[model samples]
Target chain A: MDLIRFPEMSRGELRALRQTVDGAFREFTRIWGDPLENLFAPLARLLTFLENLLIDSPWILVLAVLAAGIWLASRSWKIALGSVLALLVVGYLGMWEDTMRTIAMVAVCTLVAVVLGIPVGILMAQSNRMNAVVTPVLDMMQTMPSFVYLIPVVMIFGLGKVPGVIAVVIYAIPPVIRLTNLGIRHVAPDVLEAAEAFGSSKWQKLRDVQLPLALPTIMAGVNQTIMMSLAMVVVASMIGVRGLGQPVLQAINNQYFTMGVMNGLAIVAIAIIMDRTTQAYGRRLQKHAEAGK
Target chain B: MSAPQEQGQAHGIEIRNLYKIFGPDAARHLPAVKAGLGKEELHDRHDHVLGLCDISLSVPPGRITVVMGLSGSGKSTLIRHVNGLIAPTAGQVICGGQDVAAMSDVRLRAFRREKTAMVFQKFALLPHRTVLENARYGLDIRGLPAAEADGRARRWIERVGLKGYEGYYPRQLSGGMQQRVGLARALTNDAEILLMDEAFSALDPLIRVDMQSILLELQKELRKTIVFITHDLDEALRLGDKIAILRDGAMEQVGTGQEIVLRPANAYVADFVREVNRGRIIEAQTIATPAAPGAALPGFTVKARSKLDRVAQRMVEAGAGAAQVRDPQGQLLGVIDLPAILNAMVNSADAESEE
Candidate 1:
């Protein structure tokens, strides 16, 4: 019996396997490089444009927009003022442009994640087979090292803000999909029955009944997706995605604790601001749904 | 109230030879089940739960047919089958000449949209929608334009007594009020058939009674063919033109409240009626004697349709030993004596306790 022992395979077969894989990657790049780059170039350009716009825009206008958004979401002038003060403190630490850049990237990544994830989640909710198929894939995406996705992302999009956005999307999409599926599933069966009894078609039920009821849960999922996107920022910075993450990376490399702490605090500020806004928005939607009734 | 006439062309519902065995492969046990396997026997031998068996009944048009049973007696399953929500293992549900169980998806959708409306026990109003929106749901589903649907919904909202609360969402309403919205939604659909599955079972006792009266009041004017499911015998007696009593998925008895109360078809039915107050359900005509030949009628006359309890109340108030029972047109039909009413109320209690 010619069983290949692990140690023996490590000496010769491992090297062979590495060569085969490396050759496959090279051949794949050779064949698919132009088409793939062409597909991603527009997206890359959009990301670059957004990041630069945020970084170069006048800081006062950006802060005003941010504060206004916070105020709208929270329905509280106090929260808006507090967020503005916190953001101004970050600016005083000389990280205003970087903070805006980070916010822009997080925004794009979250948008892409929501756009792609919600449909997938609805599909999963509609069919148990789809859920069974996607659940393990989601588990892998969530639990596997976020850095591991960057390897293939770098190979495909080739080291830029696009690759960073792609990485963030991959990291952030699972929660929305899982939660959206859960939200749809958890809608009371009696309500669905009432809809069916009233002769709601499949599409009508989804639009008028299921999705509306599921909105709060889906919003919670969006909140988690945003948080996850922010968590990916420093890792995304590694592939030349410029943002506040860049300085934190530099601080780590140069062992400069103060720079790391200051940049880290800015990221935290952004995260807190985003989290509270999303949560407040979700609560408002719930209140609006129940308002007057 | 009337004899079981031919249900043909009347837009009534007839469920024939219905049998529902719940299992992964209920079809496989059909032969064994039809050959006289009992519910527990099926469970122990085939690991299958029997949901309904030989549930043959006819729901008269413009009247309520109450299917009464305890929780697992398959009353819910029976009501759901009317709308094709649950398919029976074997049966035919002929509603408006369409075999509901045999309907294809497209035809079934049409049947549901055009022919029927349902009220739920949970008052399943869409929480996200306002009272007006929820009420308009059925019309909206039928593809009516929003303006038309809204107009129809508003009429029903007022009819069901939620006129001022049109913009209110379900969460802001109390339980009884939510059920009013549910009733409004069903009524606004204007379907010929209304299926209510324990529609008032979730309400508080006082609210349940209030809702029941509201339904009775609406039913007088609308006269839709309503199939109402309930576990409460009193509710069945109050609402059902004909009540079908079920036990372990089999029909134990099918009759009017008077018929079932006076002459139970079997032990299961007798047990069910044992706790019922006879005076509340037995109509004046049921216990009325023939009028004294060529004699003057009593001073007070009770309507033939009036229950014995109400008749007793009127008789006691009028200080009469016997009251003439009159048809709706005021012609004397018979006379109900006070002793007969007392005997009915007391003897039944004594008979039940003696058992």
Candidate 2:
């Protein structure tokens, strides 16, 4: 090792380095702020109960999930059959219980994200300054890589299910905001002009014309939000979220070929199931708008 | 430009030197704008488009004034000033006695809610609401109880022949039907001044005629002051009590149908009238005089308001020496023979036949 010595830093230089270090540390703390009643304890409890409960009744959970996939595939017996077979295979190889736990987590996480995310997306779409300010922060949240987000979230919320959910939301919310802004901004000018001519006030125009017209695209955003939440499931396992991903990771480590394959199939099934259901809902909304027009 | 004087007439609207220029560069160019410049003169001087230039016209109570122009002729901009949807860059839009251009936002809202309603070209019924609900939206915004608004909306819907379709969404309706809903939405408010910006322009031609008939029936009953804008000359001739021909943001002429067709103020007005079927537009009451008992009269019953060309056609059709013209009360006033029709056409053509 070449041991190199430099002249000791002046006091101001030392202070400047301290300030930079302090600023970065402060940012780290802010990024993962307060998550117990807000974050960790309840989430872990919910995750543990779901994980344990699914272990108690894997077959029921698996069949219940196939129902949505069937409904969404919409009379496609082949796709429905294929989806059900996937769930059965996951069950046969003994990862079915863990898969259900992951499903429950995703369902809970997506619901929470939409409720919170939509209003924020609406707000972001509504104001230019807010969109300008929020968009970069969202970009940072998404682009920071999956592992970097977990450390602070895990540190503050401290190792459990709540950290996992929060981490997923942070990762997934950007698409919802981006697409929502784009959708509302893209409503036809002629349509909006008609609303104004009708003497609809600002609020009425937004509620009646803007929102209804922008709905199809917003639903597309919602679908993307849900897909992103699912992507977070596998990454969430490192923070001790004991879902299907844990079994997949364990089987990979242990070289249990049959086990990894079954768990992987279950993950694929969950993604396909969620994707189809949300897409169906989006189509229904599109039809509703067209019918209204 | 004429400074406005109080009209002893009881009109619902009186515009005085109302100007709408594009923006900041307008004031700098004002010195160069004449009272009314030719189209090319305007294009060269403004370096900006003139929308409604120093327009001063009126919409009389119980009458329809159709402001006729081509697409960029500022017909829509002129109507917006009447309802206070937009303020003029110069001059006043007087409704009853209040100046719409000077009304505060709250007052303008109150005025729009109470005294004026507008129909748009695209039939902008709310997609989220059913026909009845969309029609009631204006009333609902003014804080009327739902029951009251819906009751009134139902009546208007029935009036517009949309009774059975009240529950349908706008998308469920056909284009003509959707336009009826837009019409019903405006009519439900029962505002005195109805501003229709190409109200039936989006409908099919046959459907548009039906809508015009419907509007005529409504006007007979309600007697509202109506200011309608259209690029179509025939629609104007059919519906207008007074039609103002606009060319490049200036009024070419403002007069009744016969006044424009028989005696257009300028060539711009003449070209618009030339293509219109004068026989269909000019009424028997317009051109008829007290019947001359001893004249060699044509055997056709023609109206005094009948255009000279039409009376001539009737004369040709009848193969008579002259045609008898009548007024609204069935009084035969004057004889229009073939020579009279040909002479009138030739002499009027001499004045307006453009190079």
- Candidate closest to the true structure, highest DockQ: 1
Candidate DockQ values, in order, are 0.59, 0.32
Clashing pairs in 1: A293-B169, A293-B172
Top lDDT: which candidate number? 1
The Cα local distance difference test for each model comes to: 0.89, 0.77
Task: Output the chain A TM-score of model 1.
Answer: 0.93
Q: Kindly list the per-residue Cα lDDT of model 2 for residues A63-178, writing each as its tens digit.
A: 87556556664545555666677777766777666777887788678766777777777888789899899888988988999898787666666777787888888888777777
Q: Which candidate leads the pack in TM-score?
A: 1
lDDT of 1 by residue, B1-355 (tens): 1214353323789999999999999999988889999999999988999999988999898999999999999999999999999999999999867799999988888889878999999988998888999999988887889999999999999998888999888888899999999999999988889999999999999999999999999999888899999999999998989999988899999999889998999878888888888889888887788987998887888899898888889889989988889889987788878888988876465666788
- Model 1, residue A32: distance off in Å is 1.0
